[model samples]
Target: MLPPPIPSQPNVAIPTSWPPSAYTYPPLLGNIQTPSVHPSGSAGTSFGYSQAHQQYAVQRQFWATKAYQSSVADTITLCFKILREVPGKPKGILVRNLTEGEPNVLASITPPGLRQLGIQRMETKLTAALRGLRVDWTRIPLREIVIWVDLAHQPPDIAYFHARCMTGKEPQPAPSFKKQTKAFELAFVIDSEYWEEIEQQLADDEVRSCSFSKISNRSSNGRRSSQHTLDGSTVDLESHARRPSPDQEDDFELDRASFNRNEDHSPVCAFSADLTRALKVSVTAPRTPPPSKRRIIYQSPNQDHLRDALLEGGSSYSQLWGQGPNSTSEQIQFFAINDCSLNDLLADRRFQGFVCDPANACMGSLVIEAGNYLGIGTFKTAEMGYLTLLHLTAGHLGPRANEPVAVKRMYKRRKTPTDANPGKWVLNRLTSADEHSKILMEANVLFWATSIMNFTYSFIYHFIQSSSERPPFEISEIRFVRAGVAIVHNQSTGPTTLKCSISRTYLIEERINEAKDGFYKFINNGSAVPLTMTRKDASELSEFLAFTQHVQFYKTKGAVYLSDLQGSMQLLTDPQIMTSPLIGEGAEIFGDGNVPSAFNSFPEQHCCKHICRWFELPELAASTDSDTRSVISNS
Candidate 1:
């Protein structure tokens, strides 16, 4: 005999005075089957056993009463089932290990419960409760059923049911990257006439189950040949829906002959009453293309080539990316991709190329990962570790797009307070505002250098603070421009310094008429000199004057060579020239390109050397020995 029912607990009352059609929970009752009792136990049970049976019978009777039906007992039972089965919580499958004091459904809902059931948050609690009764979906509306199944962690079939109910339309399945990808190998497999027969059988029979038999292909000679069994039933070869022969329909043939209906050359007007049904069937059997085929293309970086391509001067790009002398910890922080498994995604070439194109040119999704730092001048040395324009577009590295971009990772260096060496470098984290300030400061410096000082280089695209905790990266949009050489033939200024103090605008004004006249003279008689402002000419001149002024100011302020501007200038000079190539004029190396004597009298190298000189201003050294050593080494 089965164990007797448990005793009834005090029930929570549910409201029920709403409209008749209002959503209501179906009444839950204990199984109504007649209880079986063991004959031997009934004849020889002890007093305690007898009392237990009486109590059990009373409890079962109590549940059967109207009072039990009026309470939240059924909802509570459903809630218990969901709490037991759902995943990813203390009570769910994902987190099997629960805290010592976590409450179960029964404990949570009881009056003496440690935690309240949280009825005020009805959506979460009530939705979960309804979803717990998954097998009994008929109690809920179609829409509610869909949402409940989704939230309950039910299988995808629930979604399919909702889709079918909404519209007798099948949804196209998305392409899966996994191995088993085919949906159906054969198209139009089912015969429409056979399906109608099954429907008729279902409507007519009391059979608890129905199954397919076999479908045979019709041969060209109007005979059934290849046979396939579905269940045990044989599919008929001839369809009853087809038009009957004229011999079979004698009256129709007679009417056609009598009225000359057969050959009036008029079209027959036939109405299809089941057109909607046919359309529904056609729409419900949607065909989706098979999964995409992918070919793997691996790109392995050359460590030596990459390492050799580090940024110039004291700043090392590799340090930021753990490719240089400094370890990763020496830099700020890392920006990790959120939500998705970036490693797995990146490993798949198709996903990387199509989905995660850093340039975001593809039609698919795009994700940008950049580090963020908190302050201005984070990178005191030369910026490094940023992606190059070539690398970004080169199919061997990033996406195959013509878009050009240069990534620059900047950082600031500061001396630790407790360190003995006052000028020693140390890495530190900054606040978000500090990072914003740093970017703004760089923008300001570049703006002034570009607009007021007439400096020129690749322009910045935009600033992005990807992560506040990590050092930020910058992008430079590359625009190709042809460079012409301009010779500065001034004898008064040094190769790294400028002869003129005025800006490029005034220089242009002073030489404009002369340049026009010279050009006309040269074109006509091949006699005059050329006067043109090549790339970086203005920037070089400006930097030269700026550096000179900086040196003068710092020299008066008691700055020494080793510890001040002079030492800095030495490191920057080489890189600046390489980048700009206009700072130092070599008349013999680059032939004097017929520049006007008047304009050439005040030209700087028009290369990056002037920028280096500006960045690296020399201070007065302690003695001739130190100064001579520095000068000799720099030269």
Candidate 2:
């Protein structure tokens, strides 16, 4: 008899201020309007500008020498100290050079417009300026350039900036700021490896600058009195500082007319086109999906009668069609009964004792000794959406005797009230029998899928370990549970009466879903699809599991692949085996969860990351729009 369900823990009301002060940041400052200053060209203004510029130069000099102190040997750190703050304007943005003697001033921009120009634009400008200082990026790899923006606010508004790699053909979008404090301090960390390309872009921009100047001078009647703002905003001296002459005014009108006529042919538009073309030609195509659609073809003769007979009150269901020996050889014979190509793969010596081999198939029968249940007739029940798990002890079973084990059964849904016996409930016999068969079928396919996964993982692990180069992270182990269907006898009813067809008990630790779909969905790159977990969030173990799946899909020639991965860090359970429908017609080949849509979506969904690339797994060609149409039509 099954034990009563364990009582659930009582819900406790959480206090609004339950989180202590240590977890929270100080109150944020309110937004303030940025003032626009029209420079009067007074001695005071000139002196203030010169003083701010000098301070910036000194700050740059300090960082030039001290930059090596904070970073590793291969990287360079540039510190940008905010000398002056003007709300909504760029001023006093400075960084030091690596060269000795005098510190080269980088930029003098105010704080207001820095956020608008964004971190990526600032990094690009810094990179161009740094290149002008003749710093060898290759020697000290500038894959990521960190910019520290120290705004001289009352509470110290500080920020760090970096850009994402411009690897794609399209223009990379500007990075958003992540607020670190109550103050408007932000952190924008991005990365890019194309240094040479950026240098060329700077050269193009320089040419555009010259062209812009020539046109501006022609418009202003060759007066050439203009001040270029540090934040890329232009300030006209004739308009702001002094009244314009009639000839200058006429020239300005003419220049405006000319600029309006050639708006589409502007230098910015031309530069954008050139940049897009260069990026498109230089960048490699994104990763393709997994190859292979071959699924496991289960040719094992139907054993539905074994489950039916048990459901009809038989003592046991044996693979050998009779009373089997109480020994390990009996279990090995049970696995041999499957008679499929997957069984052949499992029989290999590499997977010996792990899942199956000639000697052992990680399967055995345990006799439930008298009054030996661990909780003494009591078991804890954990109910999930489709199955109910009972936590109990098998008792006096072998090496694992008295250890906690979990027994799983499908939730019975067809209970009817008995009129003859008032208040008594009875399950529909036919539905109960069908559910029993399903439980056994699911267990059988699960075992087969786990064996294949284990085999593939073993191959990939050994391959990586034996290679000349090592991966960045250590390859962690991932072992799925070895389970099988078993028949429980109801001794209380009478010695030979069948109890139920259920899964053999296996222990589990704290469980977590590493990846999942309808059963187990593989996470894609975060850019295209929104998922709870992506390639970035995957741990070393998850990556290895993903790689295993990749190899299995390809090695089996795309016949079958495992997904819906969930388990402890080392041990996993309840995986979904996705088989191509081309191999079999029915969904029940593996289980009800094995759908054709999931199988078809594999190429589009799976995001190949480091481990896949490390093994140099062959890329799966993406199906074109026409191919998809044909598949839909055929289906």
Candidate 3:
């Protein structure tokens, strides 16, 4: 039988008011539905229950009354955001065990009757008396907004996380549940047109959701692909509206007519510390960020602007992302991608050969791993890990710092030692400075212009290794420029010291001229062992670590190019006249097909000591050359 209805006023007719269309609760308010009630024990009569009717007669009668409609319309609004936990907290999903006597997060705001029942809650609700107001979005202008939030505890380069050890991000293989505890806090309306911007975002979201379902239904495996596709599309759409890049529409077709190569959306994009630092720099020191949803900038020729340059130095580039002096405590800080993942940077073709001296060239191009947060595997020590070119970075691009970068793919992946460093090689033989020096001088002389330095190698390796001695493991980035530091690894847990000093910069023409001369000697003149590194390898490395801001690699006539945004992607050339270091008398190693006087005297050393220096360490150490016992033979 239908229950008796709640008592109503003498005039029980439904109300005609703005509350009906203004709020969502009580569903279709003021609808003229029959409100017959059956009397089981109420002061009013109730109708017998009809199974076919579905809804209760009493509920229908109660909602139909003008008094009931007024109550539901008083409901206020609230917002929420999904986020993940940072590192330095419990890792690998710590089981939740609520503490005893935990503070009552939600106060007792239920009705007088429900309050007596003593049911604790976590959400506080408030009632707002109604004031009839029209919400015509078209007529009303929108506003912009900037927001900031603070969470107590956090970790470096970790994302979607807060102080409570809760990571909103559900990485594959992690336990997930339907109901997630809310931990996000927000500060809104900081910018001028904040409201309008939010309204536009919401509108765009609605359109994308509607179209996403339609598009997915057409795919053969739409059901499984829906989630990623929708996410990728939503990000692209939002980026286009908010921060459009020049090459956002540039197409690079794969085998399929429309391949979903969403490389820009890697987990690295979600890194909080790195992004915050990038934004800080972008805004503080203004550099027009390359257009897109992708945050990385690759160095390319003036001909092709989308491509930014790669100046890498480190075998464990992945371990040191979004890092700074305070990176350890703050989970989400903005940072520069001076040492970006070569894999991510090189995903497109525009990445010309990672420029390094002929000496460190053996260290190879940037090693890239498109894994968690765009892992940049081991690179040569000759390359500097930190961004030497500070002016070019956009760390503080303000609120628009996270504008999705439009990365146009110009180059395909090429398999070479310079570019390939997967996640598995666990044993990296350490090379001594002397052996590396030999190679820098002999097989390659690029080392003279560029030198290598490792600050806290053991500190990093011990932290990242999964088990006993993985060749590539976690590395701790020491803030100071360490020189002649000693790393004594005793069971992977010990103190290490970094001894480094001030920094210095060199003229470009001088280095390149030496390179050209050495290049000719090694390739054209057919020297038994090429003059790679100069006498200043150590000093250059020390100075690079201690002082260089950023190493600018502007090719005189190189393979890559950069496109200008003002026009239709026109190629621009660097104005400087940088002669190859090998050509003129101004060159260090090779001047007019002549070896330096030191090489003339020290022929036995062959002026190629830098290359062999890196091999002295076990990871990069070489075995005895039984075939060529001459130590520097077989060239």
For TM-score, the strongest prediction is: 2
Q: What is the per-residue lDDT of model 1 for residues 274-337, given as tens digits with 9 covering 90 to 100?
A: 2112212221212342345344569998888766665332365434544344312111111111
TM-score of candidate 2 versus the correct structure, residues matched by position: 0.32
Least accurate stretch of 10 residues (summed lDDT) in model 2? Answer: 377-386
Against the reference, the lDDT scores of all candidates come to: 0.24, 0.39, 0.23
Span of ten consecutive residues with least summed lDDT in model 3: 564-573
C-alpha RMSD by candidate, in order: 33.8, 35.2, 29.2
RMSD of 3: 29.2
TM-scores of the models, in the order given: 0.16, 0.32, 0.18
- Candidate 1: misplaced stretches above 4 Å? 1-379, 386-413, 417-423, 444-635
Name the candidate, 1 or 3, with the larger lDDT value: 1
Can you rank all candidates by lDDT, best first? Answer: 2, 1, 3
lDDT of 2 by residue, 191-296 (tens): 2234344445545444333223222322233332344432345444332233222222211111111221212222122123332343333332123423443455
Q: Is candidate 1 or candidate 3 better by TM-score?
A: 3
